[model samples]
Target: MLGTICRFWRDQRGIALILVTIMLPAIIGFALLAIDMSRANNLHNDVQKGADAFAIAAAAELDGAPDAWTRAERAMENLVDNTTRFSNSGLVTLASAGSVTVNPGASSCRSRGNISWCFLKSLPASDSSPITSSNYATTQAETLFVQVTVTPESFSSIFPASFLGGSNGLTVGATAVAGSPGAVVCDMVPVFICNPFPGQSLYEVANSGQFYKKSLKLVVGSTSWGPGNFGFLRPSDGHGYGETDLATDIAIGRVPECVSARRIYTQTGNLTTKVKAAFNTRFDIYANGGGFPSKSDPRWPPAPNVRKGFQYASNGNGQGSGSQNPCNMELATDATRYHQLTRDTSFTGQIGNGGWDYTGYAAANQMTSALTHFGSSYNNTTNPPSRYDLYHWENTHDSNGNVVPVGDPNSLVHTQSVGGETGVPACASTVGDEDRRLIYAAVVDCSDSYVQSQLNGQSGAPPAIGFASLFLTEAVTGDEVMAEIVDIAGSRGRGTMENFVRDDVQLYR
Candidate 1:
């Protein structure tokens, strides 16, 4: 049969040669078609990956995911004809009207389904798991698990099939599930204290909420006087001096304790206090809550009689002040509010571990020993207390295994160390302890505090470089409020992975 077809083609006498010639190329062409198909398959696979990445990114709210998908879709949208929705540039542009259509799982968890997809929500402030993490639900019941599905119809390379038929596009699908490592919920942030110093101890016993010192008329400086043991605690779980340090006075070294000491919060001459009940109602949405700030909770106005922040505080541009201004308290934004978050209820009843400044007390004791350094009259009791610099300290466990040492800010010497308090067992060891400085610590509750005999006792001391005061921002649920002590030198503080410490720390005995 093969010879008959070839013989007729050479003779050119029969129509068989023309049919044979045509069929010959057709057969060869079909084989080439298979080869091209293989190439197209490879292209299809590459495009699929791009499509998958794009789909997942679009489904989530990653920083630039939407725009990224736009550029990618532009590169491949035309290959599959104009019918590809995934390849639609309109859904990923500056004016994108795209919304993720979540096909909920059987139990409301998208993870249960085959097609899942997603993206990360912009910084969530709650102690909840990130929407992107797989263990989001395990961390908190508030976490919703959902599978995302996307159809990037533009990924198909239909043009290659034009030889056989015409363009016929393809569609791709993908999904993702959110989760967390463990249930987390600690919202009690202790930002301010009766005595604000880098290194000092406090006889801390309660896990009471931290008080507002600067915002109100309260104490900020720690004293190196008074009697009684002291205790200490920090939000990061770092332990410190947990001994009696005078009733409420902190000291750098031994000294004739003050006749009476206090932390000032107790003398409520003229301090401000908003009803927690009223403030708690901030979560309640107003009846007309439909502008840019969407409301997720129930609606209720300030009950007329309940009262809100001073009047309707307006925080214009956050440059000015408003009692209820969203700009001022951005930390409480509805989407991923960080302020109200606290550790899980399971751990709420507990206290926080305290930390100490290794060099604080060491330097204080050393200063007390000298009475005067480089020629100066040290008198911590009343007038001229010699100025000194306290710098450097290493972790040394206190009697209670509290690894904290109180030291003055900078290397400024304490008046007792430089003026008076000279001899004490702790002082002797601290003075000679070359690697560290002395520290003073004390504890006071809501209204307990002590101050320098004069607000500016040792004026010569260098100012605390950064924020001299601390204020605790209430924790919210669902996401974490990233706290970093990013000093110019990059000093790493205690309490977390890499570089995050709770803004406020609670302690339990």
Candidate 2:
């Protein structure tokens, strides 16, 4: 028996089988761990991608929408709850198993969600802060910054805990920060006008719902600064710009940043030629269409009514009422019939009862006629197309004695018949018409001190309170260029910071 035992102990025939049995569980455990690790990595990458997408989407609405924060949260939730992947060769569903946090003007990451997963929380404020990335630290009220964090719940590993030190659960997270650094407007007109309404920003005016009711007459040649005064802008050197360069700038939509930064002054010279060129460029009037004469048309010149400038009598007669007057006589010809068709009407039902002078009423009437003609010619489907509606008047009483404005639900201006006729004609859509004007004049704050600063170039360029789109109401004369305030472009209380006409969204961290 002893001899048999010794021989068996020495035998190595089945020793290989024992070794295989001992190492098999450890090998299987390692393979399972690798598979779990791969799954965790994939989940990490997917969550990171979701966070990035959500942050960017949220950043876009920060300026325009009232419910920007809510919208952003929803976007993140949607992505996390919908993504799915495979685990252990079997499909595993992924949900919003983590919390999401939002910090609008966050200086540093702090506890925001239930899960201790804050975005950039460990980063010191000095080294990594949202303000550092955002150039406008002073305008924090208008600027918006966002942070998002995604932490998935622990996922069960396929590896058996008994073999591998109970490493059965895996959790991963990702974070991102996005910001909207305010707006930089391109294609702005060089002219600046003092804000007529003091102590109230354009945003305040818009919010008060009174913007549409106010009829402001901007005088182009006036030197006295007041609520309704306007003037042509000159370069820093006080010299007038070339007409061609000015027109080209309007067409291309922006002046050089360096030039725009310099102070602008009221033009001293007669601006008749420059005004006509600018107006023609905006309306494409020199180009052909709408029963109007093209630049190529030979019959264009004898009829001064066909020109885009202020429609004044060449003989120096303001109203041109006399039969011999060129303005009054030009309307008789067929080529000038469009001009005749646009004459203002009165409540007595008499046509041509109104004078075509430079008065505010004349300007308003001229604008209406031009818009109507343009709409009839260019717009195929809509009558009095929205682009032509430039006037917004105060509220009017209804037939039932209740207050009502035309297009009440969407009306921006109140319209009432004054002296048996409406001062401003109604356009199909006021919102659409507001953006039609090609010339935009900046509204500067005209408060006593601010005005002085602007005049002396001490305050740099005067802070633009708002912008007004100009609609030529009358043809250009020697020194007189008449236009109506068709639309106002600006926000209330948007001081110092550039207006948010356009926005750019991006990831800061």
Candidate 3:
């Protein structure tokens, strides 16, 4: 028996079973540890997704409104409903700080839900770094970004705690930061006007009817412009853009550069003659000479509606003989039927009151009934809708394109014509960027000492107070841009100007 036992011990046959028995526990333990690690990784991924979704939702509502933070919090709580799987709990819904005050420096957190977050006007260096007082946003306008932190999810691992000499529970967490990308505006017009109402905030002035229907005569000069005065903007490249370049940009909408919403640089020079000549192209009036595009060129097509009060000579008025250029004849004074609009009485300098010649203009255009459509809002003598308002009304209110006294068979559909040319475009068959008559210009508060100091030769960028949508009332004469402020950039009263703004949001971390 001893000899047989010694032979068996020396033998390798069936010895593998003993080795397997000894290593089986350790192998199973490693397998369980791997399963636990996989579960933790999956939980982390889910938590990260939840954080990202919540942050994006919150960032979308930071549109400079008064209750932006409150709205952001509400959006985060109500919008996202992420549930995590692969945890010990089987399925766990992500927690949120449901009801918490948004204190500036301190994070808004809730222990019950176990979520923490904060608003930031700017960004931090790293996603893991804590938000501090210097970077936190206190007001709605400053609340441009949001940071979200999900509470750690604890789950028991399948592995035995005593085997690994550690706790069986594993924890996973995630964080995300989202906000609006820097306000980069593309295809912006290279013109800026001083804020007309410096006394009131941009929101207040936009909402108030005081700016509506008001006429502004924008002039070009190297001198310092006050409120209502207008000037040229330097492209972001900082090149010395001359009149030729300015004319091309104004006429064809060939933008020089994209600009930042926070600030803009100014161009110094008197771009009067070229500016006027180029601006008139929108009115279907190309100059016979002076390098202006001919009427036949489709690239510089006129607006669909060009009803400036003036007559032109078919023979290029001694310029390009027999060329039929519309810019041949100078626009007649208001005394003549072919007249430019007179300024409003309420404002001084370049800014006009809402009081424009609505009655006389309507009568001349045979749209008197359009004014009556306002019904009690039309005073006939006072408080009449501006020509810009009437222009849009005429465009949409008439489907068949009839003018005034709609149902009447005698009322002419082709009633809007002045100086032998109809309101309808005659230059080109197709028009591009149909808002040709509309100019989206930056409104800067040049009255500010800092802004004033930056004018003329200075290189400093002056902040734009707001963007104003001005309608070209008539063909530009000399250096003056005869326009009416129809709408401005803001939440209060955004009309057609909303089309120009290109705000986008993205994840910072």
Question: Model 1: residues >4 Å from true position, as ranges?
Answer: 1-146, 155-159, 162-167, 178-410, 413-419, 422-498, 501-509
Worst 10 residues of 3 by lDDT: 405-414
Candidate 2 structure quality by residue, lDDT tens digits, 73-160:
5554454443435433244343333454334555323232322122221222552544333332223223365566655545677887
**Full ranking by lDDT:** 3, 2, 1
CA-lDDT, candidates in order? 0.25, 0.42, 0.68
Estimate the lDDT of model 2. Answer: 0.42
TM-score of 3: 0.72
Q: For model 2, how big is the CA root-mean-square deviation?
A: 13.1
Q: How far off is residue 44 in model 1, in Å?
A: 8.6
* Per-residue lDDT of candidate 3, residues 312-341 (tens digit): 543535322344444454454442344344
**Better model by TM-score, 1 or 3?**
3
Candidate achieving higher TM-score, 2 or 3: 3
**Model 1: C-alpha RMSD to truth?**
24.9
Against the hidden true structure, what lDDT does model 1 obtain?
A: 0.25
- For lDDT, the strongest prediction is 3
lDDT of 2 at 125: 51
